[model samples]
Target: MASIANKVYLFDRDKNLQWTSSIDNLEDVAISADGNKIIAVASNKVYSLLVDAPEEKFHFPVGYPDAEWYEHESPNGQGWMTYNPEPPCYGYHLGDDWNAKPPPDYDDYGDPVYAVASGMVVYAKTVPGDVWWGNVIMIRHDNINGTGVITSMYAHLRDINVSEGNVVGSGQVIGTIGKGYDDKLPSHLHFEIRYGDSETVGIGCIDSELVSGEQGPQGQIDPTWFINTY
Candidate 1:
């Protein structure tokens, strides 16, 4: 699979022009089954458009921070994660274990955190004791079209800038990378694009897994899709 940073070709069979998009330096990638619907993260928000749909079809809002804190029942106690999927070149700590404490250069955290997609700040918290995910923010992206999309989460932040209910623009700055609370690894952002609702999603910073219920999903969606579209 291609890393999120590489540019991909989008062929609009019905349309004449072939559009090209790059995912380099972007946050996430979203694509419809046939490669028609496209959404990609630029800075703090996502940009999206359907081949047959008008510009109004682009639904992601600008800025918003996390309002409430999420406490999941985990066997290892409460923890959070960062999802920086820029391939093995950037942000990715491939052989590095999530449970290992970051080296001295990254003791405090590294890299400023940006929003994956624009939306309202619905949940934010900076509790001291979290082991895997330190400071966290979860924004709810509005998908009014009922395309089956909702909030996206930015976890393990070193600092959060906005509060709850605030509206932010696409590609806005929300936070910075901090020492992860639970993972205890390098400072990086954990990004998750939630479909339908929360409570069910993937896990781990690297070796990303699709977590649905007690079991993880079978395959990983090409991160390239979400990173390229925005």
Candidate 2:
């Protein structure tokens, strides 16, 4: 498999083209040893498809059944988001800080963090001496209806249930929410949706640099928009 000019091409042993991906901005491509599956990475997402079937889906990283969770919208209101990308505290918030509603502060601690989609765990480890990220897990999901690949990152986790290279199913519990390294800051899940590279564990946020206009930093997208759209 090879990706060039935003296209992915699959060829048989004879080098004859067997299939061409309809998606664009594909940065890399790989095939399983058995040649039964193909995984491709785009500028802001990743996609994998079976040789015989092609489909993808996504889910919320927190909450169960109905995903009864909400993002931190304001510092004055209940739940997380004391600092955001918007005014007041104009920090370069790259992702959404998810929190369970009602009776905030440590109430949601240790809550299970789920895999938003079926994919391989590309990165999972606790950052040593880093109080902002704590435990982080990144899952790379294949193309969503031919829209390229997407990665889901869960941070500030209390416990990591899944390891790197594990293929997890959508909604599978991968970890539990927690405060940072030394339990600094209030308990909440700092979640992000990154594209392109799946192995890089980016700084949760930055004070400078905007990747997508004023939306977010480079390689990151709005977690709320991604969850609702996909």
How many backbone overlaps does candidate 1 show? Answer: 40
- In model 2, the clashing pairs are 44-195, 45-149, 46-149, 46-150, 47-142, 47-143, 48-142
lDDT of 1 by residue, 16-134 (tens): 55667665556555453223456555554455534464322222111122211221111232132222323442233211112223353434354445454445566777644546657
lDDT of each: 0.45, 0.69
Model 1 Cα shift for residue 23 (angstroms): 36
Provide the lDDT at 160 for model 2. 96
Tens digit of lDDT per residue, candidate 2, span 1-230?
67678777888889999888677665555554334567665554446645565444466777753468655665544335522464333556677787787664438888898887666788899876665678899887766545466778888889999777666666678899898677876788888887654677767657774644344443687777666777
TM-score: model 1 vs. ground truth: 0.44
TM agreement with the true structure for every prediction: 0.44, 0.68
Clashes of each: 40, 7
